[model samples]
Target: MERLKLDVLGLCETRWSGEGHFASGDKLVISSGSPDGGYGGVAVVLSAAVKNSLLSYTPVSNRLLVVRIQATHVPITIIQVYAPTSSCAAEEIDDFYEKLQAVIDAMKSRQVCVVMGDFNAKLGLGRDFESGVGDYGLGQRNERGDMLAEFCRINGLVVCNTAFQHNLRSRYTWISPDGHTRNQIDYVMISKSWFSSVLDSRARPAAECDTDHHLVTMKLRTKHFRRVRCKSMAVRPFDVTRLRNPDVSEKYSVATENRFSLLQDRYNEECTPDELWDQIQAGITEVAEEVVGRRVRKKPPKPWISEEVIALAERKRIARCTGKDQEYNDLKLEVRRRIRCDRRK
Candidate 1:
């Protein structure tokens, strides 16, 4: 996560039982899965920065989940899904689409929706549905791919990956172990209304996660807006520690008394408990701000990355670039092993 610099990451086939929030260092992970046993699961891992703007999260099913984040101009709804494979029964595939459509329909009309994850559908290169797909897609269309394309057409969504042109290496998101097969099964899709907001989308095959699927990401030219209620002025905390000084204590006491006297003269007995508390709180905050000034918060420290791992990663990259395949493979294994060891600790 630290290496990727991702603000929000959608994970498919998490295979974790039950549903709940878990903490990994400073990151927060919210996942939903099957109750019967580990099988299919979906999750969204948020960085501390994006976590603050999170509005709500819903676990639609073991295969799907939605997270709403308050953005600048509009709310952004992200739907993460792990669709059933093509080998699955037709009925099961139909059920998945039904539930997915319901989730999309439930979203607010004004919200910008992004649906992404492992669709297990290979949307091939075709211009038959020009409005739903671009000419840059990979491979040939199959039954599942047709269904996915149809779903996009009905919902007025554009497959972001296909919308942008890229080389073959950057187009395919999944690769078979035999290295003979490559397909663009995973995707990131956004509502047609905000299609222009997507700057680019591609697969990062060189990313050294142990998964066979490459990390697919879409860059959006948008910003998150602060919510209305969140825009209200926050009362600065009083510096109570200053009260320990005799001179400061006397001054604060005098200020409090003067403010209270003015409040009493203005409201008398008609002021409710709530009103009185508010006035007092405001008075203290004012006095503190005037006397000691508002507190300055320090930025949180970045996640630590060891120098040894950094050096190993650099060497691995160099080896790959120099065509030292054997050395690159060895260093890649070492990097993964070290990462696992560090994560365990």
Candidate 2:
């Protein structure tokens, strides 16, 4: 199994609370469950190869569990969730979605997250994966299931298990409790960006066990072949505290404002309002040139009329206006007055 490079194994609704069996080569990352017992249980199993440690293990109220892993070489995270049974009420499923979204938002900085488990909802009636069984018999599409499909789309996730393309008879991930029909409920959904890493995924056939759900197996192609450059690249905790520093942020903002103001003044002197907008847009092309040529060491500051700048500006204004042009002066005063009025309102 070590040679196999199996990074992690996750199981949802494992009946027993204690450690489950693992092949001789694997190791347990963390296993969590409801403190009470049976009803809703989930577990995460990690391999010895991964460098990260379990940052947190939370078994949520809706029978959802989160295993936060912090890898050293690569910051790869796995979020496994098992939704409540479809037989449950619609409100219950909606709640599940809300909590799941919350968890996703919190884990955004993890770089890559692989979400998988028994969603207990068919994606949609007639949607296509890049490749899949045409008649994957989804029994009548339920409203909640449709919503889940929409959720996946909105979140930019792809069902990785679609590579198998097996239909209802051979494509089912779970069997109906009554043994009436097979349904493809379990899934391995990865972010569309990371979907490329899913070398292949499949719903394993029933072992000699009595369970209705088959084991969902997904092989992530995390291995990389690279020539020696640096030994490794690791991401450290970012300085989020800097965001709280008012002086730092304010200074940067002020600098940006000054730059904008300077640009605005130059634009106003050179062209009309419509032409100024055109100039700003054309400036985007110079952004690459600025960076490449190292012409600007920092981002431009916003434009502001400081006391010193105002004196120089007054000189330029006088030179541009001269003693005549009363109507132009009147128009400028009116514009300034309107700005003040709008600010007051």
Candidate 3:
């Protein structure tokens, strides 16, 4: 996650035992898997910043998971899926799409929706279908690919990966273990109406992970709105650290004592314990604000992306541009290996 600087990562074939959330360091992993077995699963891993805005999440099934987050301007719904493989039964494939469609149907029309994962459907070069697919797709269209394209067309979704132009090698998201076969089965899709908001989408072959599939990402140009709240409910931290100075501490103590004395005169002797406590709290807060002042909140530090990774990424770019296939492959593999090791740490 730190290597790629990803905010949210969709995972397929997670093979987790069941549907639930798990903590991995600072990030959170929300997954949905088969209740009867652990053969299939889907998950969405959220960065701390993004997780803070999470409104809710739903475990659709072993093959799907939906997450809703409260953005600054609107709510965004993200759906992670693990579709049936080509070898799977037709009935099972149909069932998977049916469940997926149902989830889409339930979504609010105004909310931004991002559906991404390993579809296991090779959406070959999207040549003829200009509306739902782009011309940059890899390989020839298969039956499963047809189903995926049709699904997108029906739902007014656009295939993000095909829309962008990248190197043929960069377009393929999966490779055979023998290194003889490659295909673009995994994808990221968004509502057709918001196509302009989609900056780019591509496959990161150099991404290191345990899975055989490469990481696919989509960048959107949308902005988040700040959460609304009552002003009276706003709470600021007092700069108690100022009390480290003897002079400041003495002054604060004197001010608090004076305020408490005044509050005691205002409250009746018959006041309940709760009322007295409230008065005391108010007095202390007033003195603290006037004496110590409130502490300012700072944005959390961004995840570190090291210079080594940056240099390697730049080298990869240059190698691609210069048509250094062997060098590019070597660097890509190194980058992926480093990423895998970093993530494990």
lDDT top scorer: 1
Count backbone clashes in candidate 2: 14
Model 1 misplaced regions, further than 4 Å: 1-5, 36-38, 225-323
lDDT of 1: 0.84
| Prediction 2 TM-score vs. true | 0.54
Q: List, residue by residue over 122-195, the lDDT tens digit for candidate 3.
A: 88876646448999999898888889888998888888989899998779999897669898999999988788
The local distance difference test score of each candidate is 0.84, 0.59, 0.83
- By TM-score, the best candidate is 1
Model 3 ranges off by over 4 Å: 128-131, 225-345
For model 1, residues 87-168, the per-residue Cα lDDT tens digits are 7899999999999999998877888999999999988986655448887889998889989989998889999988888898
Task: Summarize candidate 2's per-residue lDDT along 200-297 as a digit string, tens digits.
Answer: 77666522122578767778766522223343333233343453678655654565566567777775465877877776655543442332222223
Cα RMSD, model 3: 7.0
Instruction: Tell me the TM-score of model 1.
Output: 0.73
TM accuracy, model 3 = 0.68
Q: Give the number of colliding residue pairs in candidate 3.
A: 4
